[model samples]
Target chain A: MLNEKIICAGFGGQGVMLMGQLISYAGMLEGKEVSWLPSYGPEMRGGTANCSVMVSERPIGSPVISDDATTAIIMNLPSLDKFEVDVATGGNIIINSSLIERKTKRDDLKAYYVPANDIAVELGNARVANMIMLGAYLELTKVVSVESVMTALKKIFGESKAHLMKINEDALAKGSESIKAQ
Target chain B: MAKVLMKGNEAIGAAAIKAGCRYFFGYPITPQNELPEYMSREMPKVGGVFLQAESEIAAINMVYGAAGAGARVMTSSSSPGIALKQEGITYIAGAELPCVIVNIVRGGPGLGGIQPSQSDYNQVTRGGGNGDYKLLVYAPANLQEMVDLMQEAFDAADFYRNPVMMVGDGMIGQMMEPIEFKDSVSRFDLPEKDWATTGTKGQRKPNIINSLALDPAELEKHNHKLQKKYDAMKENEVRYETYNMENAEVVIVAYGTTSRIVRNAINDLKEQSINVGLIRPITLWPFPEKAFDEVPAACKSLLSVEMSMGQMVDDIKIASNGRWPVSFYGRVGGMIPTPEAVMGKVKELIGGEK
Candidate 1:
């Protein structure tokens, strides 16, 4: 019985929406009911962007994560500032320590500070930072496999952008190792 | 085809194209902009025409033009844009043209913020245009239902030779969910387009497409005839769903995105030993008035939940016919009511009882 309400947030260019989409797409591949809702309108243009991703075994009802009952994948400082309190007291918060300096303000949460940006830069592409954060999230929760995510990535990027897959995979590996090493 | 992950706005375009609607005209608007954008990209692949008109009014009139020519056509917009097209919508309705109008609703009294809101309920259901007219409206709850209804809307429009509306909030337009396009099963016996102005080649009488009647009594007769189609739609096209409806204490009535939220509330309440039933209307117009008859006499009361300030409450009250004292719970101006908020409302109403 897998039901995870995930809020993935960061600056607009940080691929936050893509992270949410990948989780949802991977969940669907694993035969789970999933939904992804992106934050649209004015804020999405080089501003803070976020998305709510829900993966469940049963039929999904509301696509909203109003109570923030499950997990938070925060990539930037403002994202952490905004969504840190939104995560449930006993829930999980996977922070990108590369961009965000502060720790979780609440002590009850299981927080993992992964250097997603640093890892992505080391992998030679800062854009894959989101996948690093996603890797950390998957490692922390095991909601969906990194393999399913790779399949989702291939399908999303299609055959046109096939060249970028290697870096993304490396970022996902580094992200997973970041949390496991802790 | 297997289920694919697609956004709600993109799904609308795909569904319309699947339904044999080859012509689309729409203006750019937030939340719903993806719909037109998708059409622009995909319509050409299917040998369809996607035209971004200069304005929303222009787009709807183009729909009217294409519909009068007997072509399956569609146009879409958000709240403020939908308002701009009301006059053309009325013209299409008065002419008895078959076209689909999709309003991916945004919060508004005027040019309001682009967020999910069902504030267009009254504007859509109560005839936003002038005169006595009704557009067959479908309010789909999820991405799957959204595509399903988009396909059905074209059929309904042609079947009744009237404009059919598919209204979903920004939630339905912005969310991405797994969806498989199903073969459409139309509920109406589609009549021929004999009344279309397709240039008869002098083979018969010219079919004049006009909504004008200078004679007072003549226009009255036309209005009366149009009323029959609306009545037939009520008789044949009503769609709704019920969940946990048997002998429940608090019965809820909701539709579209709000209905999904209510479902969560019902499931949560069931764990606490509170029996809650839900009646979700798929068709906003025709009102699903008969669904209220299914409520058990053992039920305590009815609650109408919406993303608006209770526009649908009037219809629920009329449908319930004073059988139960109906109370309304709502969050307006782009604020979506959460399941917890709805639970509190239901418990409040339940607490007052007994």
Candidate 2:
């Protein structure tokens, strides 16, 4: 029962890989089995990028989440266009409303839209948009606790970048609040 | 032990360090860059040498040199790079040197793609290098296995005074999983390396490590010695795993990353009451031919599933020796067969539905 397959996709610079890693690391912190696989190639910044992340109680069979993604976090229009159909039936689709003007076409799945970029910018740091989406994912799925995620963030940022931790925390809170408001 | 999440490449690097390997010579390749990258960052801290060789050929020769000097050395690469190291590997084996080599296999015939593939089975097991020598090959199924095998690989190489290989696909290099590193594992008490090319300053005798022998009889004698070592490995080093094979009607043979997928297929088939079993080979060189001997009486057929174009199937056929109807299901060119597809193949082989 403790299994979740998530696909986070966006432009290369949208921190999709980091978002996937954070989820995987948080799952590991909580003693859950996890895997993170990125679509690696010559692609870099501004290129189509995505990562597959799995948090499960049992060992994962495949890291490549081809089609059975339980949730898809689309951070841009192109990402949504590319991965919207990959969401499993009765799955969830969380979209970044700021860049993704279009809505989900599927009727069977629940969709939540948050202006992650706008919220990050309003919170005074645009780099934390991925954190916003991650926060929304945590609130919706509860695969890992928010406390575990914050601890993982502290481990990642560590001493050098510890000053930006508060903004990321704010971004996460704003994301969860946006989901609750709807 | 505290478990930490790590990529397979990073785990291999860490395990190598823990196994007392102080020399690493390799070039960067896709899906396995994290290995050398980790070494580059950590080797300096341990006062070890991590050199990025100019090419795979140079890297392997450097391994030959370091191993000849009695240092635990390793070099890693993917398919194309491994191909380039064959000559050096052959030379190292001929000289009876000890070293570890890793091949994080990608799709190949020649730079085919950067995706995970088990197509290197023949290349790694059938001696891509020119020799009658066999490298003790270990195929790990997961990140933790990769780490554990790395430690064992170093010991095996040193104990046997031969090169040992750890073969995995790109998926094993790229995926992240939880792994716990143990302090140490049991190792054989190997003989003193009086054959090593260490400096002979007022020593008993100077040693030379070379593969060349002009006289055919001398060369043949050396080959016989290597064959003896290989025979001993065959008798003792075979490792494999069997799952749900107690009373199964069909057996599936797989290894490394493919075995996990086959396990998934087996789980699904169990739901349908098909009773499919799996034999996963951990050591590819010894081939675990004995595992095939214990097939259940009710088992009617054997299916070999791999991410290659029916390569490992040949070994299964050889091991089964035509006792049972053996079939092959595979995907090549960087493509991986899903669990459902493998189940479909099992259904086809089993004549559909119990």
Please give the CA lDDT of all the candidate structures.
0.91, 0.90
Measured against the native two-chain assembly using Cα atoms, what DockQ does each of the candidate structures obtain, in the order listed?
0.89, 0.69
**Highest-DockQ candidate:** 1
TM-score: model 1, chain A: 0.96
Question: Model 1 scores what on Cα lDDT?
Answer: 0.91
RMSD of 1: 1.3
Candidate RMSDs in order: 1.3, 1.2
lDDT of 1 at A134: 89
Q: How close is candidate 2 to the true structure, as a TM-score?
A: 0.98
Q: Which ten residues in a row have the lowest lDDT in candidate 2 chain A?
A: A59-68
Model 1, A98: alpha-carbon shift in Å?
1.0
Q: In angstroms, give how far residue B208 of model 2 lies from its true place.
A: 0.7
Q: Give candidate 1 regions above 4 Å deviation.
A: B352-354
List the candidate 2 regions with Cα displacement exceeding 4 Å: none
Score every model by TM-score.
0.98, 0.98
lDDT of 1 by residue, B111-195 (tens): 9999999999999999899999999999999989888787679988998899999998998999999999998677667888999
